[model samples]
Target: MDSDRIAEIIIAEIRSTVPELEAQPITRADSMADLGVDSIERSEVILATLEAIGLKVPMVQLHGPRNIGELADLLHAKSKA
Candidate 1:
């Protein structure tokens, strides 16, 4: 899947993991922390997203993304790898 699709899944997982964001508008540039998602909730979102995409890797490998878009791009690259 492309980055945009991965981003969609990420957004869905974020909404599912954080109900308060259900009504909030999320975008590629949005950061989970900026959206009031706690670290635990962020981890949950990431794990759920990884499951959705069927991509398994070390949690450390998923770090360094500055935003959802970057995360999507990273996941897309990793999935292809």
Candidate 2:
């Protein structure tokens, strides 16, 4: 239930799922548009991240986030709570 751990897992999952991201680190301020993350791809990343941590992420909550950083923050907060 740690924010930093969740962030780390998310970044790792993103890199694993999208091999093109092998060299870059996920950033909080980066937009999904800049990263070429479409809606479906974003969902894939989120789902992978949740699976990695043994969590069942709610699809309804997954609708709006655009990048791993924002999603990580939300998941981290939920974990903490």
Candidate 3:
């Protein structure tokens, strides 16, 4: 999938996982913490996003993504792979 679509998916997952985030505009530069996503919420976001994209990225691999844009990029690369 394309990066923009991947981003949309990630954002949607975030909103679903953390309802408070639904009211705020998320940006590529915004870290999970910046958006009030705690550690547990972060994990939920990661798992949900991976599931949504139909990918099995290791949890360790997910550590590299600092924000939505980077996560989208990683998901895009993995989808292509």
Candidate 4:
């Protein structure tokens, strides 16, 4: 899938993992940290996103994205590989 779609998945996962943000608007430029998601919640979002995209990789390898867009881009690249 494309990065945009992956970003949507990430956003969905974020909303699902953190119900407090259900009414909040999420976009590609948003970061979980800035959204007030703790580290554990962030990991859960990422893992859930990965599962949604049928991706299996080391959690450490999924680091370095500063925002949802970057994470989607990285996940898209990895999925293509």
RMSD of each: 0.5, 2.2, 1.1, 0.5
Residue 58 displacement (Å), model 3? 1.4
lDDT of 1 at 72: 97
Model 1, residue 51: distance off in Å is 0.5
- Using lDDT as the yardstick, the better of models 3 and 4 is 4
Q: Model 4 residue 51 lDDT?
A: 88
Give the clash count for each candidate.
Answer: 0, 0, 0, 0
Better of 3 and 4 by TM-score: 4
Question: Which pairs of residues collide in candidate 2?
Answer: none
lDDT of 3 by residue, 1-81 (tens): 799898988888889999977889887778888888899988998898888888986788768787889988988888888
Candidate 3: regions farther than 4 A off:
none
lDDT by candidate, in order shown: 0.95, 0.69, 0.85, 0.95
Candidate 1 C-alpha lDDT tens digits along 12-41: 999999888899999999998999999999
> Judged by lDDT relative to the true structure, which candidate is superior, 2 or 3?
3
Screening candidate 3 with a backbone cut-off below 3 angstroms (N, C-alpha, C), the clashing residue pairs are none
State TM-scores per candidate.
0.97, 0.74, 0.91, 0.98
Tens-digit lDDT track of model 4 for 1-81: 899999999999998898999999999999889999999999999999888999999999999999999999999999999
